[model samples]
Target chain A: MNRTQLFEQIKKKSSYLCVGLDTDVDKIPTHLRSAADPVFEFNKQIIDATIDLCVAYKPNIAFYEALGPKGWESLQKTLEYIPKDVFTIADAKRGDIGNTSALYAKAFFEHMSFDSITVAPYMGEDSVKPFLKFKNKWVILLAHTSNPGADDFQLLQSTGSGKKLYEEVILKSQQWATPDKLMYVVGATQAEKIGGIRVLAPDHFFLVPGIGAQGGDLAQVSKFGMNKQCGLLVNSARNIIYASSDKDFATAAKSEATKVRNEMENLLNSLL
Target chain B: MNRTQLFEQIKKKSSYLCVGLDTDVDKIPTHLRSAADPVFEFNKQIIDATIDLCVAYKPNIAFYEALGPKGWESLQKTLEYIPKDVFTIADAKRGDIGNTSALYAKAFFEHMSFDSITVAPYMGEDSVKPFLKFKNKWVILLAHTSNPGADDFQLLQSTGSGKKLYEEVILKSQQWATPDKLMYVVGATQAEKIGGIRVLAPDHFFLVPGIGAQGGDLAQVSKFGMNKQCGLLVNSARNIIYASSDKDFATAAKSEATKVRNEMENLLNSLL
Candidate 1:
């Protein structure tokens, strides 16, 4: 989906929330274990419970991949189950050489039909450019991640540019793709930095994780990260999906999602 | 495989050759498309032909992932088919937040049983540390890549330490894992730089790709990059695997692998 279409979805739903499907099989409800594809079954219910309350669904690809080829099948099924109007993200942080990256773009964008795939920027331009080649697809490059290790190299000062490595990434990547096709994964845990990051790429969308289970303050992220088009996809995974480990897990998820959405609606109505 | 076992295999094979199974289904011989699992069939023949000549088999994950669930099956079958003596590399180049990285490590190391998996160091210590938790597994972090875009961020000088970005990666990563568990992906294309990178992590093995088809110099790499234990796995993918497009593809692949192995053996004999 293009930036306008995504923003439209957000406005229509009165939310910019992106529910993450970090669905680990071992953590799923015990009753669903007997299902043919428990992961997909779990995701189906989560999507059903929360689809009206969110604009996108981001599936952490690692959870599915850990199950082996069967995991990939579950992921494919989950992708097919999500409705077309809501955006889908293959939260597979993939990047490689140009040719190899092209095949990845083909896998996520063409074959499985995800609207976007999170890419690692360490391999630099050619590694990321292939994903930008697909029309209407987005490339959410990692910048200022919420993980503790984000400080390791991302915040290092570049002698040449005098910018932090993540800052350099944000500035340099603008030459590759515009806001229409490119976005940044600015972790919501770094709530204060979101404003600074916003100033760097004023028009670009930001796929913000680290809010729910990571204990990031949503108000801070919403205040600093939102833009004219509601340029934020604040993702909440564990706190919603695993709200309950019983038969009422989906209902619990919906309640948690509804609470987050109600607050997001107030913010969108007032802020955007 | 442990470091000693890997070196033993290198000594036994008299070559540090890593056959890259960057197997594009479209490029495989047309006759094999008729097989029940054509990609797996193609890989089986290639593995049968080159297993003796090469010490490690690095299957580029994108090739399999692009084909969807079936592609994953092909990869699993290929992994099971490779003998225990040969070191297997996922070449997935995956890294994420701590928990996520753990899942990826579980996927590749536990489920797939690869000896090593290439990881992107963009996220720093925690992102990579989880992979090190696995026994006898390796994390071959990207230090300097072969693609043209490698110049974009890797070579940038960091002001704080006065080291290039990749240099800092090599230096700082040592604090997280011993050389036995950690390796670097120092592209053979930049043969001269390999010497400098090797100095930073003297004991760590380097998985060198970009030879053959990518025009990396084998002689320069072997001369500058080799350690006492022949600490380099020089990969050649398209140059060897797609050597022939006819029914004699396996024979052609064997011939090419034999030529590269011969070169590597000479390097080991004279240099070591």
Candidate 2:
């Protein structure tokens, strides 16, 4: 969906919660393993249970890819299953050179039909621009990631610009595309920095992925991160999907998602 | 293969050349497009032709991934077809959180049985170390890439160390893994920087791309980048694989491989 449509979805749902599908087969309940495609089955149930509570679904590509060929099939099936109204982010942090990046764009954008795919900006402008070419597709650039590893390189100061590498990324990348076609993956763990990063890209959406399971508070994220457009996609995967391990897993997922969505609704009410 | 074994393969073949299997479906021979699996068929022929000449085969994952499940099947078949002695680099360029990174590591090293997988170092130490946990499998970290975008963040100076971001990456990443399992993706396009980068990590192998197709010179790279063990696997993808788009594509690929290998033999002779 385009930026306007995405914002509309946020307004309609009163929740910008993005349910992450980082579905690990081993982590799922033992009962589901008997299914033909355990991963897909788990994803299908999660989608069915939580669709109303979230506006986006991010399938962490590593989990699917680890399963080999069957994994790709499952992933394809999962993407097909996800309703088009909700935004889909292929949390496939893929980036390469010019020609190769185009191929990656084709993989996620054309073949799989994801609305956006997260891309690592360490490779620079040319690596990012190819994905931006698709009319409605979004390029969610890694800015300040939530992972402990974010401290490793994201904070380096550019020799010329004197901005932190990610700040440089945020500023430099804006020249490539407008806020409509681009977003930043700002980790929810670093809520203090969210205000600063939001100021840098005031209008662009931030796909925040650290609220649950990663110890990030939604209130702080909402307070600092909400734009006039309510531009924040707070993602929680394991916390909701694995809320229960048995046959009640999907129902439990709904309960957890409802709680989060209710919280999101109150936050949105304050902002609107 | 281990570093010593990889070096031995270089000695045995008299070549440190790495043939990149970036087999695009549209770019393959017309006759092969009619086959059961065109990409695998094309890769099979190319592998058969160039197997003896190159010491390593780096399959650029974007090409296969773009084709979806079928492409992955082709990659698996091609991986199975390649002889074990030659080092296999899954040019997947993947990196994420600790658990997620492990899955990607399993995807390539365990599922596909690749000797090494290239990873983007943007997310920091935790994102990269999981891939290092695999025994005898290498993590070819992206240090200096060949694309025009390498100038983006790679050249930025770190706040504390005053090292360029890529230099900081090369130096800081050393703490996570030893030279035994860690290598750098130092692009051959940056020949002038190779000597200085060589000074930082003298023992670690540098998987150099951008040689033939991207205007990188082998001799210049050899003059600056080579170590006592011939620690460089220069990659050539489109130039070798798409030498001819006809049924003679394999023959032309072999001819191109022969030419590159001959040059590499002379370079290795001087180094040894």
Could you say which candidate leads in DockQ? 1
Output the lDDT of residue A234, model 2: 95
Each prediction's fraction of true contacts recovered: 0.88, 0.90
Worst 10 residues of 1 chain B by lDDT: B263-272
Model 1: per-residue Cα lDDT over B1-272, one tens digit each: 89999999898889899999989989989999999999989999999999889999999999999999989999999999999899999989898999999999999998988999999999989999999998989999999999999989998898888999999999999999998999999988879998998889888899999998889999999899999888899999998899999999999999999999998888899754
lDDT of each: 0.93, 0.92
- Each candidate's interface RMSD: 0.6, 1.1
The per-candidate count of clashes, in order, stands at 0, 0
What is the per-candidate TM-score for chain B? Answer: 0.99, 0.98
Deviation in angstroms for A93 in model 1?
Answer: 0.4
Q: Kindly report the docking quality category of candidate 1.
A: high
lDDT of 2 by residue, B24-131 (tens): 888988888889998888888999999999998989999999989988999999999999998999998898988899999999989999999999999999999989
